[model samples]
Target: MAPLKTLLLVVVVLLPVANACQPPRTLHVPVFHRDALFPPPPSAKRGSLLRQRLAADAARYASLVDATGRLHSPVFSGIPFESGEYFALVGVGTPSTKAMLVIDTGSDLVWLQCSPCRHCYAQKGQVFDPRRSSTYRRVPCSSPQCRALRFPGCDSGGSGGGCRYMVAYGDGSSSTGDLATDKLAFANYTYINNVTLGCGRDNEGLFDSAAGLLGVGRGKISISTQVAPAYGNVFEYCLGDRTSRSTHSSYLVFGRTPELTSTAFTALLSNPRRPSLYYVDMAGFSVGGERVTGFSNASLALDPATGRGGVVVDSGTAISRFARDAYAALRDAFDARAHAAGMRKLAGEYSVFDACYDLRGRPAASAPPIVLHFAGGADMALPPENYFLPMDGGRRRASSYRCLGFEAADDGLSVIGNVQQQGFRVVFDVEKERIGFAPNGCTS
Candidate 1:
């Protein structure tokens, strides 16, 4: 991957602001609740605490700020994976071993493909062995959670308890295995031990880069919910990129806030309509100082049965996608800006920005300014460099193309990926009904 060019310049001026009014009577955010499938086993709480201490020490050694002045939180990068996906390494079994897994907030379970096969692509860390873990147990297939996993054509009549099942991703990736317990380590902090996770006997199209996923959702059994009982119901991560300055110290704040100086941005409590999940009130979206009217209200709803929300905040996604009209408006604005720069719009595989030019031509002397306006009157101005990706078609020429793409998903919801989220402090408050954003120094 080419070095990420800093393209957006943000100047955050601290402002004194009053907190939004709190609604009377705390709202009961309906979350999918499940009884522990397996009995709680004895754990070394002191050992867990000791692990946390080691994590703090590790963080001190890894923490560093880049020249741009933005704090580079510790992160583990360069784990191998296919393009356009997210993955992480995780520990499983009596003695924790590492496995590469997808880090999916859209998912509720942190599972791994496990077996005796030596050819299984694995990260350079410990491997999870379910047979050796005494606490490992499975939920019955008849259980509600397992039944939910059953697809439209999948047969529910299975002998396995809720502990064993299979799951398929939209990208055609699938993992089949028994649900079992294992230890999980985050930033050296052993937050949960003998936690329920997938022990897969087989997986197809699984990325070998990540050990396992860290499911950060609101489901009762998800990493967010399981650790909430211990960590104060929150986890934070800064996406990794070539420009990232920190190392394997990337953080996962479980049951506690990652240490940072509080800014003037008011951390609104999440709306109670969504339970066990982070839903932020998105006031609206803007571009170039003008508000795009008729966007969907930021209020989100969580489906307690599935432990998923109607709308979610995902940083791993590379662009900020909106519902139909919002997406069209943003695209149209960008197209207009590109046309103004004298580029002729073209339609082709390498064509982007609704405009294109032959690589042999002189590049435009100037590009128009592209800015995004957010709720609470914050404006993020992005330069042309931020929106374009450098492409080398078969010809020996260099051409810059916009990195924007819009599509309506089968799930009928919009996604804001890393492209739009670049250089912003995204706060996900599960307790509050709103997502908050502030500008960061991401541009040169």
Candidate 2:
């Protein structure tokens, strides 16, 4: 009896030490693309089709925002463009199934196509059968969770039945379904039970192959917020390089304290119009060390009243978009440099770009570099590899069409698209309200 008592005492003392020495909870998952979701493959040298899709989505994304905010209840969509290039594998339901979820930092709700579907977009794998999962639980409309989503007071289903949700994007894409709580499994074999998410039934529009969305936005119901209790208030993602043509997957890291070696810093702001988006301050822009003129500081400030002039680091957008005035300056600067180098202009081209160069005579490596200067000493340099693309995109041999990667937009908001973000690790620190950037993110 005395020996047993001594052993119990030893375990009680050692257990605390063991746990204390353990590292903070963390999650890391791979993010990669499967295939081109929409029709018309990307242009080899210039991603015209890709740019169109992203720009259209960005426009719609800006329009749908009310600027009134969603503090009381969350209302947003993931992969609202009807297509997504990259997705993350998320395990949902009991006896977990690995579901390919679209990655969208612009949204906050992590949704999945649930079983007993009435209407759903065609997905790659088997639909999640809630009946098979013991952990599956439908949230009632009266529940606090449902109420917070503004439940809409149930539907024709019943007065006190499962909560229903509907989110419509500006481009007419929408998801109508029930709100429920289920276990979400991650790549690290760690999971959280009763993670509130939308179990979409009548999901419509152009979502190719993705079963759902992994919303990593700045909202109360976002997956980042849901897991913040255990993982802390930090997440980092290193978008893999598209030029490498390698099979290595990019990564998404969540931790209590983000590990960063970057000296640059930028303040994350808030706008009532777009509450879920991660807004950051952009002090100014510089093209090869030349500051843009007529681009006032007020042009890019966040304003809910006007519903314009804000910036977000989005994972879904492929290329970067700048305000009309700002883009004109940037375009002229880049075009002037290209013209000085004796590059020929491709005439008779009807495209979204203002400057399209005929690169058949010169390698894409010859293009000049551009830099986007952010607040707090963050200067993101865009090498030829980051902004220049072959018109043929290696689709065929013996083709020479390389163009600069940039676009003009009428919207007041500016975006740091995924293309410019490639080859770097972008850290979204909501706790500190700052963003960090580091090179060589894939291996880091």
lDDT of 2 by residue, 213-274 (tens): 78787766677776665566778887776544444648777774446565366787776666
Lowest lDDT 10-residue stretch of candidate 1 = 1-10
- Compared with the true structure, model 1 gives a TM-score of 0.62
Q: Note the Cα lDDT for every prediction shown.
A: 0.40, 0.64
Per-residue lDDT of model 1, residues 1-444, tens digit only: 000000001101111111112221111111100001111124423223323322322221121111121211112222221223333544455555655454444446667666653334544355566677664556565444444333312225554434465655432345667765555543333324546566666665434444455556555556555544333444444333322333332223333343333311333323233322333324444444566555455322224444332333553343343445555656666556666655555566442123344423535335445555444554445544444444444344444433344322223234444444444444444554334444452211
Instruction: Find the candidate with the highest TM-score and give its number.
Output: 2
User: TM-scores of all models?
Assistant: 0.62, 0.83
Q: Pick the candidate with the highest lDDT.
A: 2
* lDDT of predicted model 1: 0.40
Please state every model's RMSD to the true fold in angstroms.
Answer: 15.7, 9.6
Error of 1 at 66 (Å): 40
